[model samples]
Target: MKEGYVIRDQSLPHFLTVTIVDWVDVFSRKSYRDCVIECFEYCIKNKGMTVYSYVIMSNHIHMIVQSNEGKLSDLIRDFKKFTSKTILEKIQSEPESRREWMLERFKLATESHSRNKNFQFWQLGNHAEEIYSEKFMWSKIDYIHFNPVRAGIVSNPQDYIYSSASNYIDLKGIIDVEIVQIPVVNVLKSSSVVKYNSYEK
Candidate 1:
């Protein structure tokens, strides 16, 4: 961990962004991104992680998340450890065009730090911001959703399959998310809202 980047309150939800080392486009391929999706699913189902929203881009990922066990930091650590090893293995086993270059970069990153024994996949420190209010939460969610759009990958956020936007719009997503349920004050004749069942509702 880095100074001032440690998780202080594990109970609160956080907006976290994790980038690849050296900004490598490791997730440009489906297999690499699938590894991330698998990790997210495994963590959510078994590691007590609660993911409200997420987006997987070419070289990074953004998520709105916490942990049911109040061990968000531990969950992140485990997820990164497992994914780094798995992704590195895949890069070695699979026919990757940039295998040598990518492996060299990861090896360099690992050598630069004493914590790693072989390679470093994710960059140090998750840029995490604690979510305090509904407004801030929505802002972070929108920012996460529009990342691909801002990068010109897609025009509509919902069109991006590797994001929570489809899940929010009631589409079957790559991974299930625990949507936050905001309290509703009133309902008009022609207007109603969907409510989600989860801990942080």
Candidate 2:
């Protein structure tokens, strides 16, 4: 992993990107995407995870998250491990059109790493960038929300059902998130620095 991508502060919010092996579009299916949502819910309920914002793309996920227990690394490790096993099992058992193709890609990915016993679903390293400033935090959130739009998936960020952009727009999302309150002033456009306000419960 690169030096800048390391999660030095586990308790602070960080912008994280977790991609699938070979960037396979495994999450294009609703079942697979729901699997991810279930895992996130479990983490939040049991692992002390505090998700500010998130977006699930075709082959990757972006999250602005922190850990109440200050164990972000462990939370991430467990999340990937459990989700990998569960999703792989689902692919094998469920009626998937791309079952063999996806399984082959996952199996081939394990060739480079001896850690994986059968398949490597998620690629290594979260590419974590700690949210050091409010501006940086909001920028990542915008980047995450606009991903689908940039990919031409949706015209509006909130229209994407799998993203927390809906929550920010006063709509209920697939999962609950700690909504970060944007400053009253238009700090994003200002040249001066600004601090993050408290989150809305």
The prediction achieving the highest TM-score against the true structure is: 2
* lDDT of the candidates, in the order given: 0.83, 0.86
Candidate 1 — which residues are off by over 4 angstroms?
182-201
Instruction: For candidate 2, report its TM-score.
Output: 0.91
**Which 10-residue window in model 1 sums to the lowest lDDT?**
192-201
Candidate 2 displacement at residue 15 in angstroms: 0.3
Cα misplacement distance, residue 201 of candidate 2 (Å)? 24
Summarize candidate 2's per-residue lDDT along 1-201 as a digit string, tens digits. Answer: 333578888889899999999999999999889999999999999999999999999999999989999989999999899888999999999999899999899999888888997999999999999899977888788788778989999877788999998888755889999987775586665432221211122
RMSD of each: 5.1, 4.2
**Best candidate, lDDT-wise?**
2
Cα lDDT of model 1 by residue, 1-201, tens digit? 454666789878899988999999999999999999999999989999989999999999999999899988888889888888999999999899999999999999987788888888899988878998876786777788778889999877777889997787655689999876543554232121321211111
